[model samples]
Target: MTTLHQEHTAHDHEHGPACGHTPVPHGDHVDYAHDGHLHRAHAGHYDECEQGGHVAHDGHGHAHGRDCGHDSVPHGDHVDYLHDGHRHAAHDGHWDDH
Candidate 1:
């Protein structure tokens, strides 16, 4: 199982609709994609929202990249391609849902 990151970010502002960062529903929580990373609200602060693991989509067939007709999302150190209703990030030998 993956553990949720409880580390807070250095942002001095709150994130919401007026914060300019898009809010995305991630499982049971909401994550805001800002500054090239995902942020989640915690106890009076914010968390980095890191899901540090790999979950490969074994039946995915399309190769996503430049001009793949999907929205691009900037993750921590790489890019994720939006497919269907979720984000896909390229991993070791397959695509991992971001």
Candidate 2:
């Protein structure tokens, strides 16, 4: 009779943030957080929609349409930015993985 033996091993790994973005000051602006993202709006800048409604600002002196591609990730009670594929989490903030 012949018999065979098998061996198994377990490994552990660590993961950091997912994206590569840093939060830069967009000037004196207000932010609207929604769906794990932040939508910012700055003064003096306006985003006029086809329906004649203001949307968002671009930090510069210009306005953007409804799709003003300035979305940031939402950390635990904090805001995070993703740039160059790097994730920049907010400092002195807690990370909620829920």
Candidate 3:
């Protein structure tokens, strides 16, 4: 017998710690394009190998993630942010809360 896996993506960046969900942290998430926008996922919600944040999927099931999307470095980019001061670039790559 064979099985098929379907992935559903959605945009949800407005969610913050204020919503009672812990911020998953940077570099521990993936942003997928959805509905003309990008949606981020936490390690606890996806198959993250590098970090032990993998979520087990029982045959067919969905999981809700908390605390994610803190890392902003591109896949091939070697960029590091500072603690103090902010880097203002055109479209810093973060989802604008507009």
| Highest TM-score model number | 1
Worst 10 residues of 3 by lDDT: 81-90
Alpha-carbon RMSD, each predicted model: 2.2, 22.3, 17.9
Candidate 3, residue 84: the lDDT equals 18
Best-to-worst lDDT order: 1, 2, 3
- lDDT tens digits, residues 4-94, model 3? 1222333234444464323333343333322322234443232211212223222322121233323332222222221112111112333
User: What ranges in model 1 sit over 4 Å off?
Assistant: none
Score residue 72 of candidate 3 by CA lDDT.
Answer: 30
Predicted candidate 2: what Cα RMSD to the true structure? Answer: 22.3
Which pairs of residues collide in candidate 1?
Answer: none
Residue pairs in collision within model 2: 19-86, 19-87, 20-83, 20-85, 20-86, 20-87, 21-82, 21-83, 21-86
Report model 1's TM-score to 2 decimal places.
0.77
Ranked by lDDT, the better of candidates 2 and 3 is 2
Q: Residues 1-98, candidate 2, lDDT per residue (tens digit)?
A: 11112211121211123323333233242233333443332232322111122222223232222354544556446544433332333232232111
User: After aligning candidate 3 to the native by TM-score, how far in Å is the CA of 59 from where it should be?
Assistant: 32
lDDT: the better of candidates 1 and 2: 1
Q: Is candidate 1 or candidate 2 better by TM-score?
A: 1
CA lDDT scores, all candidates in order: 0.79, 0.30, 0.27
